[model samples]
Target: MWSQTTDKQRNLERKKEQILTEIKAVQQLLKTEKTKERNVLSEIQDQNHKIKLSQDLIRNGQQQIALINRDVEKNQAEVAVLEKELKALKEDYAKTIVKSYKSRSSQSRIMFVLSSENFAQAYKRVQYMKQYANYRKKQGDEVREKSDALAVVIKSLEEKKVRQNVLLREAEVQKKNLEAERTKQQGLMALIQKDQRKYNDQIKKKRTETAAIDKQIQQLIREAIAEANRKAREAREAAAKAAGKKTGEKVVESSKGSNTAVFELTPEGKVVANSFKANQGRLPWPVSKGYISLRYGDQPHPVQKHLTIHNSGVEISTVVGTRARSVFQGEVLQVQVLSGNNKAVLIQHGDYITVYQNLSDVYVKKGDKVTLKQEIGVVNTNASGQTVLKFLLSHNTTIHNPQSWLSGSN
Candidate 1:
């Protein structure tokens, strides 16, 4: 903002850019999100998606509008805050103006000059008069500057309200579009009935693949933990051997604690725990940017409301190839290829076990230590050719909702 000027302008421009970027990102997410994945998850996905889009629009508009309103209010508040100061200035200005008018009207600018008692005193009074005039001029200039700034702020507020109006209109369109999508999704569900056998097979394959992946992850983790423990043991023995030579006596283990951590809490549980333990309120974003599709617990599929299924994790919809990263530091217990052309990775953090399913590939193997915000794998796109992440946070083997841990990510 200020390649050439001051700090205030730079700070103002930085805030502007942050707000603008959020607005643009939300808009783009809405545009890029596809309709097919919503159908696959059932109407529940579609409804939530519509709601999310509306929320983003409303939120962005309201945020910007609020900032503008704050500016206007600040201007008004400033006027009030400085009223006493300005009042005194006004009195000084009034006296100066009155004196100047009389001195000029007398036509004997000379009589005014001769009114002085002595040469030094007369010279000093003239100088004082000129200084008072300049002070009055400065006060007038200040009032004008503040008034103009206030007007600009009010105008900006109007523009923000206008933008909010547009956002509302967009939200309505999104709602109607959501309704249309819901209806079409219902049709698709009916079609699923006709192809129930095929759909069931698909579901069965998905479950099998998931199970296989889970087993692989557990096995890999066990091996990795063992390996870590083994290495730690070797280091201890090595130190013992060195100490034995130095002191002529056998040495004991100095560092015996294992580096492994486990979060037995589900995603939601972990999120809650971490929220209190970490940021006090915020959760990390599971993926960089995406709309949540399936939420935690038993919810109807997007296509058929009658077809209820329990969701252990949230399915987040985003652009293809979007990488899934660790919301917090943890150890990789398992990574395996699941069905549906996807992979799954499980990590343990504290008492929390985070499970990220529906991945295209895994980056970390079993026993690998991953830090906060570490990339685990790219999200696997569904049949719709768009990335959909099945995110779960768990304690031990029990499921946790991904949303809680990623609350801060939003």
Candidate 2:
């Protein structure tokens, strides 16, 4: 549990870093936007992403400060304990020194030993004096050691205070940045609202193109599933005939649907599906470093208050040129191109299918096997300077939220 928590924290930090990288990419594009067609939507998206990132950074910084404060308090407590111990040690040592000073004379010491009742008594007295001296020396050394320890603790406390102050200041800076970015986003929203009809038209046009691309991807996946099921059926029939089973034995077929297709698997395929199901919440992310810009299911539109958008899968915003990787081992069933989404790769594991879209280049073709975390393709960076990958997971014809299947914090 502790390891999983730490991994989640690290994933959150990585996501923040990826957003920062995206902000920088947008800044560079804005600086170099000398072209005729300006992508206002890109700028708005960048600002919105940065605003969200800044808020996350502020929260992380505050948490860091709290952790540091705890350390400081702990150090302070330790210093107090050491101080008390050192003081007692010093007082004892001082008392011993004073008593020794009063009996410091060599003549006095000789008389004290001579005054013993017998030679044996005198020898014992001498031994007692030597032991007292050793005891006092040990006490003094202890006092010195404790004093050093206290000093070190004090220094550490000061350092923690300094770190806390730095974190506080950084949090304040992030808040300011967030405010500015939010204002910019609001301005963009206002501009869109000023000509709401035109903006709506743009959205409709984009939505139509996206729907067409989705249709093509769905068709490709359906065909791939059908083909795979055909092969599986053939293998099952051959095995059944060899086992002297009836020729009329029924074979499993692929279930057909509009957006998803589920293949009825053989026993081996069933095992694979069971394994994939067992790892539902422990699957690695398709992209190593990125943030979910858009999640699956219906969501309120980012700019329009009364509008809703449906996403079949989550969209991950990542750095340009980043490779899209497989979350688990599977067989590539389809690698096809779609308008605006670039290339799409669909892989099947047992009865389940995972689709990775918006790629520029694909590494595996149909029927090829892919290992866990294998690079499937390079995510395409569009003309707007945004590199986003759309990922989907399905069991049969039912879609599953990719976020729920991922291992790390969303």
Candidate 3:
């Protein structure tokens, strides 16, 4: 009886522990969904992960519940068998009591012993009495043992019933969590679609922005060229007497020899590149409070028909007046007004260059050092009122996928 009770207790504890583990996984899913708004790409992926986790949890819970159900059925069967045995034992015990108390009671037993004529017969009678007493005692003990066992079986059945209730509740909770995660996944996908439209607007804005910056860059380069010429002339005149080379001739020779190169270090571009490389998986969001639409490189448009296009940078659609922030530290290389009243700011980090295009105005200039996540410009919302930002990353001439470099999920 004691061993049976111990086994039942152990089984219940095991099933309870399994359910607890499943509940923890469901909690993580709930927490992950809250961050969906800040990072759509990450949230979408995270939702997919959460759904998988929920499914696994549900699978485990169902298995445990099924096992427990089988155990309950077995317990019921055992209880029925034990109850039948107890009924038979009670009837047999009643029959023994009737026989022991019949007319052949202790008076007859005493007379029978006295009627024995020889000592041998008397001794045999005495042995018979002792045997009958032992038999009655054994029967009484069997009845007590059977009754005690029946009580234990009844209690076990009750405990199993309680366990069944617990299992049902655990299964129900797992089912609800699974459904909730899938619904959240569908919602996230819809948001991505909405964000994609915003991203398209960002691309168009970028083209306009690049054009505007090109003009400003051309004028700046021309000024730098003029300054170079003046310095060259001064150096040439100073060296004329010593080397017997005319200023004009020396300038021509230097140009022909390809020796008229500037040795000035571009600390800004180098810094941006270094910072960008250093933060392979830790770059800030391109368009704050937005989602990535189409990533960098060739990808078919979500709504277009079998058409593919190349992307130098990613498009992020945002709410109106969303500011484009720097993903890494760099100096403002150019801020140009693009076509369609758009603008762009090019921030250089080391060898890496980040272009936040489509803006209304520029804030920083050529030599100003910007830190990581610094705001470069506000994304331009065109006449049509489309709010999108174009984000581009390039290491020298090679374009990089911002998706791969950015954080997986928020």
Using lDDT, give the best candidate's number: 2
**For each candidate, what TM-score against the reference?**
0.54, 0.82, 0.43
Quality of model 2 by C-alpha lDDT: 0.79
| Local distance difference test scores for all models | 0.62, 0.79, 0.62
Model 3 C-alpha lDDT per residue in residues 1-410, reported as the tens digit of each score: 54664576566556455445434543443354343335454345445545665666566556656666666677778778877887887788788778777835778988889999998999999898888879878878887887788788778768867876876787788689778877877786777567776745654564465445545444433343334345555566557655655433532234422122221224553454565687887887876565454567766643332445566667665556777788877666566665555666766565555777777766677658888777777787644334567777665435577777777422
Q: Encode model 2's per-residue lDDT on 1-410: one tens digit a residue.
A: 43664465566567657656766755554444324255666566656766766776777776667667767878888988998888889888999999999999999999999999999999999999999989988998898899889989999889879978887887888888888887878888888878889877776676677678767777776787778877776766667676654566655533543223668777888998999999988999999877677778887765665767778888887777899999988899888877645889999988888999999988899889999999999999877667789999888657788889998645
Tens-digit per-residue lDDT, 248-349, candidate 1: 996666555543333224355456556535742254676887666667777665544555566667777677678999877777767766555667787766
Give the residue spans of candidate 3 off by over 4 A.
1-37, 103-105, 195-410
Choose 2 or 3, whichever is better by TM-score: 2
Candidate 2 residue runs with Cα over 4 Å from true position: 1-36, 208-223, 240-262
Report how far residue 139 has shifted in candidate 1, in Å: 7.6
Better of 1 and 2 by lDDT: 2
Query: Which 10-residue window in model 2 sums to the lowest lDDT?
Result: 251-260
Q: What is the lDDT of candidate 1?
A: 0.62
Candidate 2 C-alpha error for residue 207, in Å = 4.0
**Per-prediction RMSD in angstroms?**
8.6, 4.7, 15.6
